[model samples]
Target: MRRLHTLSAVSMALSGAISGLLLPVAAFAILGESVEGIDSSWVFVVAPLGLAIGVGYGIARYYRFSYELTAETFDVTSGVLSVQSREIPYGRVQNVDVRQKLVHRLFGVAVVSIETAGGGDTEATLNFVAEDEANRVQAEIRRLTAAIEADDGDDTRPAPSTEADTSAGDRTDSAEPRAARELLFELEFRELLLYAGTAIRPGAAIFPLFLLLVLTGDPTSLVPESITELSLVALSAIGIVAWALATSAISAAYTVAGYYDFRLERDGNDFVYERGLIERYSGSIPVEKVQSVTISDTLLQRLFGYASLSVETAGYGPGDSSGSQSTVPFAAESRVYRFAEGIAGVERPQFTSHPAMARRRYLARYAILATLVVAAAFLTAQVIGLERWYFAAVAFAAVPPAAHLKWTHMGYYVGDDHLVIRRGFWRRETTVIPYFRIQTVTTRRSLFQRRLGLASLVVDTASSRTFTGSVPTIENMGLEDARTAHENSRKQLQRTLRDRARDENVGLSPEMA
Candidate 1:
């Protein structure tokens, strides 16, 4: 066990002094102290005290923080006043991520985050470690985790002699090779631009634009004279388009910055991801922990023959750590499909389309929503004495085609090994979930669905997040199909569990002969 880098104390001291310096200034400003009368000398007095406190705290943290790695578990003990000791078993460790920010990069240090089967942020974080030491620690943990999983599995191979185990352990820590890592995918600048174009939501720009307007006051002068003379509806439309375009550009720049030098590679049964230009990140996920696979494409992506793929692991949130953990952020549809199939251990999800009647249901639903919107706009226009209600008619006219497109693209596939659900009109997503990973299966019906003799099948997985009472569902299936899917899913889950148990019990190990 070793203490953190010496720079930690300096960084901590600087941070504390900066934090403490604000207090006296704030107090003086709040007290209405005159610039001439204000005591600038207090900051000097406070700075050293703050620095002393910070440096003492940092040194205490460094001294208290220590870790020991064993064959089965990595033990960490840390605290300032009250001591906390935690032992994380290698089998339960989900990911070991190494992150280097600009400061850390300058100092040649990295922060190591350890995530486990229990979620809600990482279980442990070791800050400000030497870059080389961080890499070695990450690799060592991964090797230990892999070795533990292999050892726990009922493999019948003879145990390595003590001599061999020690020698093998020594080699495993240093065995990671750049050449051994198979390059699976890389995101280029053009692909990142395409990703931004397809993934950014135009509606999301409204809040930021409104914030800008509030902060900067009115921008009426920026509006063109001809556009300013247009009807309220037209102006609103123009503003939305302009804002969306601006937002898309910002999103493009963010995508490039966040994903520069993005690369994905394979290391044994794990996948390694590395990216970022300014703040580098390296993370790994075990293949066996994958809960579900999703391949998605927006309308623009469809036109460009590109798609994005993401994998969900148990106890891991989609937004946790490296946001989305995209397997392929942007790739040609053909390549994405190939990778998805390989990862999912299945052929393409050629699911059957929803029944033709689903189109009628979609049309009715969208038509009602569209009617309400148009009616609202008409009423507003009437109240405002504007003859711009023609926009309402235009909106209503688009509903039927949009509904038809939704129904045309929506489909589901129930297989012995996996259940696949496909949906979305503007953005198409196909989700493939293994039966063994499913925690529950349910059916739901809305009022309209009940009236239409339709229901939805919801698949619940341990890995999926439940937010705002919403879960992933195969919506608007015929009632009978929904029930059938529910029943089949439950049966598949039970069967898979039983089969796994049987394999573990009977087939895993040969009799000692």
Candidate 2:
């Protein structure tokens, strides 16, 4: 099986490299270089270089083994010069991730990633496996855990919408294929637009704009005239606007490319998320390893009804991002809330009383804004003179950015099952993470907020993609409210787990109970 994987990858690599290497021949022909006069050393270098390219491809393909199993172990091994193998114990297994690039999908293949909890720096990745085998591998992993639960007399349930799978992997030269459940979910075009919006963030255009500015600058001087023209103020407005538009377009293009026609399918315990444009990619996450599932939306998405999804799971060994995250990319704003719940499959109680600050809530930001406004005014007052009418006019004009910040910053709320946070403009995001998935929750007090008897909360979790990865929120809220939110969420998790246990105990009556 490993050899088969190796051969397939090598073939693909060689096909591309061979085509590229032919460019030299084209160049030589154009220059009228005689083929007969070509040195033997050139062939020696080129032949081995071409062959090494194939080997490189094979090395990357490197799957030790791929198969399905019962409540025991699944083994995969393959490496040529230095053989490496792993026997992943069923109990230690954390998650199963399945992904595919455009190439793999074209070949009806999926990359299977097996993740376990025990190994500190352990990883297992099978580059190209038949989708059937990928499902088989996932099913076997879940089956083993179920078998253990049954033996321990613990009530175990299969995944929602999935039936108990009875098929076993065939152990033969011509093994009978096991059919695993193909769970299908797709993203809406509107959601894709939202995805395009976020995926192409500010940084998207920073590099391109920087490059363009550099191009328009004295390259030999190492600094652009745009930086220098800032003193001239009005002079660079055209250049700055051009830069902003260019960046927006670049970001928009990036958003489109990153998430095109995203799909996620569950094959047993493994979840496969498919996405991308030209350099297509597929990412997988395992259920057991799932730390959290987050449905997030920017303000624009909220208006348009779209959101992006992120899943945090145990990573496959080391250097394996399979269990990391996958997003719908683009989704309509209205559908975001429903889609998020659909993925979570649970109703969390949300407090109807949305937390809000009185109009005075924007006072917290007043000090900072005053600094900027006063400075701008002071500079003008100093340079142009602090004339009575001009000073009054500047003071009034400065009120808007501060007022906008205050209004935008004016929201906070608690949900029965999750916490909701919103911040930013144009890229405003509302993120929802279930209490069950909360790993670390803490609050910080800036010196000023501390003096004001207010603080901020920071929420951190494993799945680094779907969620902001790290949410450091500074909202104008009471200290007690922050603590209560954390405590309530924690208590809810305990109750849910206990309820699950109690509900699973059907024959627990009196003595037997």
Candidate 3:
């Protein structure tokens, strides 16, 4: 059994003390009272008590937690009050991630997270381990998993011992030689800047603005009386512009910081990536376990002829955005496609567009939306005795172009062994899913789509769900085309799985006979 590095207790103590200090601050904020009035004398008492409790708890936790690697499983025993034990088999291990924040790096420690397929979250976390120990653990787990898989069900064969000798004291030696890594892609500083600049995040700006309001005590109070007297519509327009600018600046800064010095390399059958400046992350994605490959570009990125490529695996759930590793955060569209081809063994697809009725449907939807907005503005103007509200009717002019762009960008293609689905105008995405990896094929029709003789075809894989809630969908296809695609996908999936099973059986040893 191996315990965490000695410094882990110190780290935990610091974290616990910080959490304790924030309790009063949080309470004051929740009660809508200022924290500035707290007596200085109470700080001495509260701080010492919090520090003592934190130190005591940290020491206890350190003694209680221990982990060991055995022949078949990586076993962990943890918890101070309620002892819980977990045994994670090497065969089920999907990824071993090493993460280091600035403080952890300073302390010469890292966090190792072990993830398994369908786990949704990290299956096991070895927190605050020595950096060398973390690397050894990651390599050992990979070697053990590979060995197990290669054994081919020979149960009587003895498994190699992977347990490390804790008495050796911080040794980093591994039993097997590490695989040579080939550099596949690296983001240049200029490219990183471009990627950061293209990030559009209007929603992320709200939190900062809200925080400012909470801390400053009122938006109107910060401005002049003359500015506060502005019309509601004018004030809203100003606020929207301010929000957009704030969002762009903050999001760009965040992107640059998060993806600094990004690099992706191939180590045998796994793709390894390292990224980040303040909080570094190094993780691996097995090529064989990949469920889908996605190529996406935002409106600005498309305009700049840049796109990003990401790969998804079953080890992480849809809600875990970090699970989908972006192999190319920002690159020339052609470059992105080339990288995707090298990784997934698939080429750029020639997509077939949806029927013309789909365009009309989009136009109708936007036109109705514009009309409703104009009517709402007019009613509000009547109530408020305002004159310029009729300007909202200008939204009607955008309907045609918006509809055309949406229609033009939506298409799908069915290859011999893969399905390519493309959609979106503001942020276009193209997903490539292998037939063998597909879990389900579904077709849906809304009342409006049915009236237009159209249907939607969805191809779902184990990792199909994404941060944007976008799935592999061919929307507004002709009813017959949709039905044909659904049936063809199912047939192809079955055939692919059968062929794979047959191949596996043929590769089995003669001892089975």
- Per lDDT, the best of the predicted structures is 3
> What lDDT does the true structure give each of the candidates?
0.74, 0.53, 0.78
TM-score of each: 0.81, 0.62, 0.84
lDDT of 3 by residue, 1-513 (tens): 889898877777777677777665455455444455666556556656766776677777877888887778999999887889999998888778889989988877888988888557788898878887887778767767767766877884335454547631364655233356667778899999999889765566877788778988887575454443246667778878987778888888878877999888766667778898988887777666778888999999999999988877775643453533676788999888887776666788899999999999999999999999999999987875557888889999999999999999999998877889888888888988889989888899999998999999877777667546566778899999999888889898889888877653211111211
Q: Supply every candidate's count of residue pairs whose N, Cα or C atoms clash at under 3 angstroms.
A: 0, 24, 0
lDDT of 2 by residue, 1-513 (tens): 223344355555666466546654555555445556655446545655655665565545433333334235666665656666667776666666666666766676666666665443445766655666555555556666545544555464332213344322212122112244353557667656655655536566578657866776753353343443233344446667877777877877866665667676654445656666754555445554555554555566656555555555543222245223653445554344444555554343332222344224454455566667767766765753434323334554556566565455445456655666655554555555555556667777767566556666666545433334344353645677767766776787676566656543311111210
Candidate 1, position 389, lDDT = 68
Angstrom error at residue 340, model 3? 1.7
Better of 1 and 3 by TM-score: 3
- Clashing residue pairs, backbone N/CA/C < 3 A, model 3: none
49: Cα error in model 2, Å: 13
Over 51-170, each residue of candidate 1 has an lDDT whose tens digit, in order, gives 567657766776788776666677889989899999998888888888998877887788888888786578888776777767766777887777766675654332211222221112
